[model samples]
Every structure is written in structure tokens, then in C-alpha cells.
Target: MTDVIIVGAGPVGLLLAGDLAQTGVDVTLLERRDGAISNLSRAFGVHARSLEQLDARGLADPLLPTGSAVGRLRLFQTVEVDLGALPSRFPYLLITPQYNVERLLLERARAAGVAIVHNAEVNGVDQDADGVTVHTTGGSHRAAYVVGTDGHRSAVRQALGLPFPGRSVLKSIMLADVKVAEEPAELLAVNGVGDAFAFMAPFGDGYYRIFAWDRDNPVPDDQPLELDELRQVVTRALGSDYGMHDPRWLSRFHSDERQAPEYRVGRVFLAGDAAHVHSPAGGQGMNTGLQDAANLSWKLAAVLRGAPDALLDTYQAERHPVGRSVLRSSGAIIRAAMIESAVGQALRGFAVRRALSVPKIRARITGQLSGIGYTYPAHRGEHALVGTRAADVALAGGERLYEALRDRRFVLIGDADLPGWEDRVRVAAPAEAGGPLILVRPDGYVGWAGRDGTGLPEALTRLAGAPSAHMAGHTAS
Candidate 1:
């Protein structure tokens, strides 16, 4: 039996598998499709917060080199959100295809020795107190835990009999990847007018992706996409098609804003589109799912090692609010961009430009879109820093803060050494800078902080679960 069975091999599943396997958990990844990976991508924007998560695992180095950085995000013809001014190492959006991100994660997963099975469709799942048994086309597999990272039409979710309650927001949204003669001046370009809306972004290759929608053209998903029709919509929105030709791929799909009521069902849990899906307006769909994987992976690992089952509840507690917020924010963006009346369009543009012109409003919008503004509910009676992301601060001896987190272990950053936690936690002293002793969780969040080691032992036991039996008697420094 495997330690965990993860359904779907998308970015979320791959990241979770890689993280778990890296720490010696036996992870089995199941995919319905064959081994081949599609070249086309539906997502292109890699925001700052997602970059920070990737950077923590040392995977951002190769990905950053493959994508172009765009400092500005044009929401409408005249309204833009400036990402260059955000307070992060990766202040700009990286315009790379979804395949690029998946490829890197798949590579990491394979490197970490994750067992991957292709062309295996999961039909159903049943769980008891001992473990979960996943029913797939090939055979049955048992595991202590299971996660559903499948897409919107999730078989795992269906087997669990959970309702994905939501409505379709937009229909007949067209997408295509092709070569263009004249590229836009900005790295990321978007424009909307009257009844049509369109956006374009390069795939770091000669090919560019065209996302066009015409509210007046209500066609079925099966309607064949003609190059002329695509050009017509582009012209209606942007005045020109930039000489689009040689379509490599084209498809039409709809958007929906749906979320599962519960993220966990006994030993089975859900993440990514399986749990929630929102409009692609803010390009938050894939990023939100990836962060979910990051937040849940460490907790699952801890539970498998020895943590109490209650620790697992925090995953849903922390991520459900973020999911709701994304749904609202992204839905608003799509609604604003889809306004049909001339008066409504003018009002949206004016309101957006006027609101973003202020320094505080601009900063808040930037932070929200970039993913740095999100914070989990604080632990009971804890410091302000608790449950907040630990900023990547530079230490004294040429060691960066995130670099210390690559080992996937909690680090106690301070001057004093705690021998009792030597096996579970690494005690390191700050170089020149002096501050309160901080306990950073495996996921890079501050679990505890104080001037002295008061309540430090109890915090560790609560957050990280009790340490090994040998260290139980030893007192904390």
C-alpha cells in the first residue's frame, strides 16, 4: 500500500506528489490520459506569490529563464495594474504557457521518485478508518490518504457525492495558439470594447495565444473555429488581428464559478479545480490551485509522520477563505470586462483608472492580485506574525531565509540552540541582525515567535505535533 494516492497529474497533483515524495512519503500519482503532455496552454501568468512558493523549493530558477516578465497588466483599453511596484523579488508577471510550469513540476516529481501511472482512470473511491481504497480502471489501490486534483469534471468528487454548486458565468470563450506577424508592444496586452473582448500573450516562443470573446456571437462549443471569425473578433476588439495565421490549435469553452462545500471527506481530500473553479479573469485559476497544493502538502506530510489528525483540518480552514475571495475578485473582473453598453464600459474604465491612480488603492490591488496579501487565521492567542508568511529575509552568514527551507524541515531562527528539537528542528543563529526567536513552519509560515523561549515547547508540540519519544523529557533551551 502506498502512503498517499493522488488523482490527476496536473500542476497541483505534481507539486503535492513531489513535496511528499521528497520527504520519504510513498506517493502514487494517477492520470487518466496517456503519458504525452499537450503543448497548448490555457494559463500564462505566473504571479509573484506563486513564484515565491516555487522559489522555496529551488524550482523557480529554471522557470524564470523561460518566460518574459510583464510589469503591467492591462485590464481594459486604458486601465492597467502595475505589478513592477510590488514588494517582492518577482514583482512582474511571468508570461509562460501552462505546459512550462507543468513540465518543470513533472520533472521534479520524477526526480523525487514519485510513482506515476498513466492512462489510469479513477472510477470510484471508498474509505474506512484504516485507509482509502481507490477504484481505477486498471485495478484497486489502497492508501492511508487520498487527494483529488482532477479537473472541474472530477470523477473522485463525483464518487464522493459532493455537489459542485455554481453557475456558468460566460459561454463560447474562444482560444487559439498561432504565429503572428506583428507582436504587441507590451509583454501582456488586453483590450475590450462594446461587445467584444480580447487579450494576447507570447509563449516565449514565436507563437502567441489569442483569447477572444464576442458577446454577440453566441455559438455552441462544437462550432468549428474559423481563422477569419477569430480575426473578425480581434478586429472588433483591438482594431487589428496583428496578422494572425497558421493556427496551431483552437478551441471554444465556457467559464463557471463553482466551489465544493467541503474540501475533505474522511480520508479523501480535494484540491485544484476539483475543489473550486473560478473565472480566468484575473488569471488566478491555476495559481490558486497551486498554492492549495503547497499549503496542504506539508500538513499531510506531518500527519503521516506523527502529527495529530486535527492538524489536517487547518488545510480547509486556511484555504477556503482564499478560494472564496478569488471567486469574487475574478468574477468582478470578468463582469467588468464583459459589460456591453457603451455607458457601462466607459464607467468601468473610468472607475478603474481613477481607483488605481491612488497610491494606497493601487498597492492593495497589486498585493491582492500578486498573492502576497493573503494570510491565514492566527493560531489561538498567538503573536501577529503567527500564521503569517515569513518574509524571505537575509541572514548574517550569506544564507538567505528561503534557502534554509529547501530541506523541508522547520527551522528555529535565533541565537540560542535548543538541543531537544535538534532532531526535528534546525536551530540556527542570525548573523548580525538580532530579533526575536522565530519558529518557521515547513511551509514558510511563522508558527511561533517571542523574545525568549517562553511557550516555545508547547507551540512546537501544538503546531508540529509532539517530537520523538527520546526528546520528550529534555527541556527546551
Candidate 2:
């Protein structure tokens, strides 16, 4: 039996597996596909928050060369969110293929000794008080906990008898990755006219990803898609296809907004598309899933090491609400883009421009889009910074906050020492004097902060398992 069994080896699963492995957790990744990572990518945009998560793992700098960054993201040609204003080291979206991310995480997982079982299709899961038994096409495996990072039709979720609750948002959406004869003026172009919509983004290579939708022509997923149809739809919706041609890939699928009623069912957990999915309008789908993995990984690691079991429940409390928020925001964007009448389209453009002109409204929109502004729920009377994302503050060693977090240990930046928690926590002084005492979580969120060290021990108990001498975990300086 392993400590954790992760079903699916997509970016979400790979990241979770790598994280668990890094902290000395025995992680087994069960992938249905053969022992090969696909080059194709369904997600092309990596938001700023995801880049921060990668930064914590020391992968962000290495990933920069693999993709390009765009400071501005245009939506429907009428609305745009300038990512330059985001308060992050990675203030803009990275336009890399999803495979690039998976490749990096997979390497980390392997280096950390995560056991990967290829061609293992998990068909059932049986969890009791002790552990979870996952039944796969190859065989059955046991683990203390199970995580399903599978796509929308998650077998683990299905075995749990969980219902994905939501409705279809769009139909006959055509996807194509090809080389465009004419480049768009902006980094990204998306617009709708009348009953059709088309969005295009570069893959950093010669190829580009396109999504063209026809409101009147609904078709089945198996329906044959032609390059001519894709070109014509783009031309109708975008005024010009930018001379799109030489299709490298082409397909058609509908978009849906779905959220599982339960993110956790007993010892099994669902994340990524398994927990929630939504309209592709905002490009938030992959970003939200990566965030889910980041939140759950640390919690599971702590719980496995004897932290309070109730801590796991916070996964749902924190991420489920975020999932619902993404759905609402993405749904609103897609609905506005699908405005059928000319007057409605004009109003949508004008309203979005007007709303974004206001500072508060613009901040909220960009924050939601970039994912850097999200924070977990802080307890009553807790410090204001408790649940907020930890900024990359400078430390005495000429290192940054995220640089310290790369050790997979909590960095306590303040005037206190974690006596019995040296192995799992680190004490560092901020480069600047008079800084507030704060404990930054491994995932780069503030776990605890106070004027003094009065509640430090209690917080450590909650942060990691009861601190023991020289625990089996990584420690920063």
C-alpha cells in the first residue's frame, strides 16, 4: 500500500504526485494511457497564479523559455484585461502548451521517486476506515488516500456515485490548431458577430489554437469537422480568419459548466476537471485545476503525517467555493459573448468597457482572471494576512520568498524559532527590518501571523503534525 494513489497523469495529477513525492510521501500515479506523454495540448494559457505555484517548485524560470508571455488578454475583441498590473512576479499569462508543464512535473515526480503505473485504468475505488482500494484494469492497488485528477468523466467520481451538476453552455464549438497566414495585431484575438464566435491564440511556435463556434449548427462530438468549415466560421465571426490554413489538428466539442456536488467522498478526492469544469471563454479551466492541486497537496501531506483529519475537509471548503466562482465568472463571459442580437452585442461591448473603466471593477475583473487575488477563509480574529497569498518578500540570504519555499518547507519569517519543527519549518529574517512575524505555507500562502510568537506553537501543530525532533521532512535555512 502507498500513502497516496493519484488517478490520472495529466498536469493536475502530475503536479499533485510530484508535490506528495517531494515531501517523502509514497505516491503512486495510475495512468490509463501507455507510458507516453502526449505532445498535444488542450490548454494553452498559464495564468499568473499558476506561474507562482510553479515558481514555488523552482520550475517557473525553466518554463519561461518554453513559451511566450503576453501582458494583455483580449476577449471578444471588445474587452481586454491587462495582466501587467497583476501584483506578481509573473504578471502575465504564459502561452505554452500544457504538455510543457506536464513534462516538467513528470520529471520532478520521477526524481522524487513517485511510482507511476502506466496502462492502469482505475475502474473502481473502495475506501473504508483504514484505506482506499482502487480497482484498475491492470490490478488493484491500496493507499491511505486516493485522488482523482481525471478529466470530466472521472471514473473515481463515478465510482463514488457523485453527480456532476450543471448544464451545457455552448454547442458545436470547433477547435483547430494550425498556422495562420496573417498574424493578429494582439497576442490573442476573440470576437463574436451575430450567431458565430471565433477565438485564436498562438502556441509560441508556428502553430496557433482556434476555437470557432456556430450557434445555429449544433452537432455531435463524433461529427466530422472540416478545415473549410472552420475557416468559414472564423471568417464569419472574426471578420477575418487571419488567413487560417494548414490545419495540424481539428475537432468539435461542446462546452459545459459542471461542478461535482462533493470534492471529497470519504477517503477519495476529486480535483481538476473532476471537481469542476466550465466554459472555455475565460481560459480559467486549467488555472483553477492547478490551484486545486496546490491547495490539496499540502493538506494531504500534513494529514498523512498525523495532522488533524478535519484539515482535509478544508479542501472542499476552500476550493469548492473557488470552483463555483470560476463557473459564474466564466459563464457570464461566455453568455455575454454569445449575445445574439446586434443591440445586445453593442451593449455588451459598451458595458464591459464602462465597467472596466472603474478602478474597483477593473481590479476585481483582472484579479479574478489572473487568479492571484484569491485567498482562503481566515479564522475569526486571525491576522489579516493569514489566508492571503504570500508575496515573494526578500530574505536576508539574498533569496526571495518563493525561493525559500522551493525546499518544500514552511518558511517562518519573523523573530521566532520552531524548536521541534526544524525538519518541516524554516526560520528566516526578512531583508527589511520591522517586518511582521508570519509563517508562510509551503504552497506560498500565509498560514499564521501575529505581532509576536504567542501562538506560534499552536499554529505549528495545525500547520504540520505535532512537531517532533528531527522529523522526516525537508527544512529550509
Candidate 3:
């Protein structure tokens, strides 16, 4: 039996697979689709925190060069507001198509020795105390753990009897990637109608991704989409019949802001759209999924490497609230952009403009959009900062905590000598640099940090399985 079996070879699944493989776990990823589709542009932005996660896997440099860095996001209405004051190292959104993101992730997963079985749909799954037995089109496979990263209609989630509770927004959105002769100069633009909106983003490939919604017109799932119908909607929203030639792809999607009741059930877990689905208003879907993988991957690794099974509980604790927060923010964005009543539009427009005027409010919203406002709660008996992600701080070892964590190992920072723990951990002195000595996890999160090393031994014991007999001798200088 494999250590883990991940359903869906999307970005989140591939990311988890890569992380697990890097940590020496035997992982298998199943995908319904054979290979990457060229015209898929479902998601087009990766936020700052996702970039850091990608960097951890040594995949960011090659992947980033394939997309554009969009620093300014312009929200269009009767009045336009620019989001430029966000406080993040990646202060802007990176505009790469979802397909490219998946491509890069697949490459990294392969390099990490993750076995991917494509066109292998998971039909059902049965989990017990020992392991999970996954039934797929090809055959049945057993795994110690199973993660569902499939899209909205997740087979794994359905088989597990998880509740996807949320309401559909009752609007039909038409998305098309087309080569246009006369494209707008703005990197991103959202034109507002009475209760509807149309957004366009130039992908630098002589193609533009156009999304237009018809307020009060919700198409049923089985309904057919006509190209002429989408063209008319585009013409009405743009106020001009701009030619859309050589259409690469066209799709109609209805927004459903649904989320699973629980992220984990028995040996089965869910992440990405399988766990939550929201309106693609702020391009938060992919970023949220990537963060979910980042959070769960290390925990899974820890469990496989002999940490307490209780570590698995933290995944839901950390990510459930995050999913809820995304739901609230994305719902607001959808309402503001698609609410039909003139008064509602005017009110939302006023509110957005007024909110943007406040620096703190703007920064908060921007930080949320960039996925920089997330921090997990620390364990009670551990250091006050043990479970929290280490902030980027310069170390005496001539590297930032985040930079040092790229190797996917645990690091201990203190003034004390940790000679006995040197084989399993890296010790760095914080006083020699401008910041505190911090213990960093391979996932680029801070595991512990303190000046006095009050709870250092206990924290290390918990994270590293058990403490050595020499732990008592590694006292602070």
C-alpha cells in the first residue's frame, strides 16, 4: 500500500504529491484527464503566499517566468479604484493561466518521484482505522491516507457522504479566451452594468480572457451554451461590438458558493475545490487550494514520520476558518459586481470607493487577497509561537528564515548549542544576526521561536518524535 493516494491531478493534488514525495513518502496521484489542456483558463492569478510555497519546492523560478506580474488591480465602476498599497512582498497578483500552473506542478511532482495515473477516475473509497481503499476505473489501491483535490463535482467527497452546503448565485457567466485585435490597455478591467458585470484580462498571448455575466439569468446545468449568445452579452457589456476572432475556448459557469461540512472524515480528507467552492471574484480559489496543500502536506509528512496522529487534527482547525473567510469575502465581491438593482449598485460602488480611501482597510483587503493574513494557532504547551508560521527574518547564517526553510528540514534557532540535535536539526544563533533564532519547518513555517528557550526542548520533542538524552545539556548560553 502506498502512503497516500491523491485524487485529481490538479494544482493542489500535484502540490501535495510533490511535497509528500520530497519527504520520502510513496504517493500516487490519480487524474481523470490525460494531460494538460491548452485552452483551459479557469483561474488566472497566483497570489504572494502561493509563490512562497512554490519557491519551497524549487519550482517558482521556472514557473514564474511563464506569466506576467500584475502590480495594479483596477476595479471599474462609475468610479475606478487602484489597489496598489497592499503590504506583501508580492504586492501584486501574478497572472498565469491555471493550465500553466498545473503544468509546472506536474513537472515538479514528476521530479520528486510522484506516480501519476492519468485518466484514472476514482469511483469510490472505503476507509478504516488502518488505511483507505480507493476504487478507481483502473483498479483498487490501498493507501494510508487519501486526499480529494478534485474539482467541484468531487467523486471522493460524494462517496464519503460529505455535505456541500451553499447556495448558487443564480447567474450564468460566459468565459471565453479569444484573440482580439483591439484589446483594452488595462491589465484587468471590470465593467459594471445595472446588476451585472464583465471582466477582461489580457494574457499577453494575443488572447484575452473575457468573463461576462447576465444578471437574473441563471442557466440550468444541462442547458446548452450558444457562441452567439455569449457574443451578444459581450457586445452589450463593452458597449461596442469588438471582434472576438479565433475563439480558443468558451464555457458557461454558474457560481455556487459551497463548502464541505468537514475537511477530514476518518482516513479521508479533502482540499481545494473538493473542500470548498466559491465565486471566482478575487482569484482566490487556486491560491486557497495551494495554501491548503501547503498546510496539510507537512502535517501528513509529520504523521508518516511518526509524529502524533493528533497533528492531523490541526489541518481542519487551520483551514476551515480560512475557507469560511474566503466564502464571506468572495460573496461580497460577487454581490458588488453582479447585484442588479441601481440602488444596490450605487450603494456597493459607494462602499467600495469609500473603503478604498482608508489605508488600513485597503491594506487589510489587499492582504486577504494576497493570502498573507493567515497564521495557525499554536499548541498550548509548546512555545507561544511554535505552531505559527515564522515571519521572514534575517538570521546570522546569512539567510532569511524562509530562505533557510527552502530545503524542507526543521531548523532550530537559539543562542544555545544543540550538538546532539545537529543530525536531525539545524541550529543557528539569532543574536549573531538582526533577528531571533527560530525553528522552521520544511514547509517554511516557524515551529518554535524564543529568546530564553523556555519550551524549546518540549517543542522539539513533539515535532521530532522524541527527545535525545542529551537534550538537557543543550541549554541557552
Each prediction's TM-score versus the true structure:
0.96, 0.97, 0.92
List per-prediction Cα lDDT, in the order shown. 0.86, 0.88, 0.78
- Using lDDT, rank the candidates from best to worst: 2, 1, 3
Query: Model 2 segments beyond 4 Å from truth?
Result: 470-477
After the best TM-score superposition of candidate 1, give how far the Cα of residue 303 lies from its true spot, in angstroms.
0.6
> How big is the positional error of residue 444 in model 1, measured in Å on the Cα after superposition?
2.1
lDDT of 3 at 152: 92
RMSDs, each prediction? Answer: 1.6, 2.5, 2.5
What's the TM for model 2?
0.97
Cα lDDT for residue 126, model 1? Answer: 93
TM-score of 3: 0.92
**Per-residue CA lDDT of candidate 1, range 37-152, in tens?**
77765888989988888888888888998898888888778787889888788898888888899999999999999999998899989999999999999999999999999999
Which candidate comes out best when scored by lDDT?
2
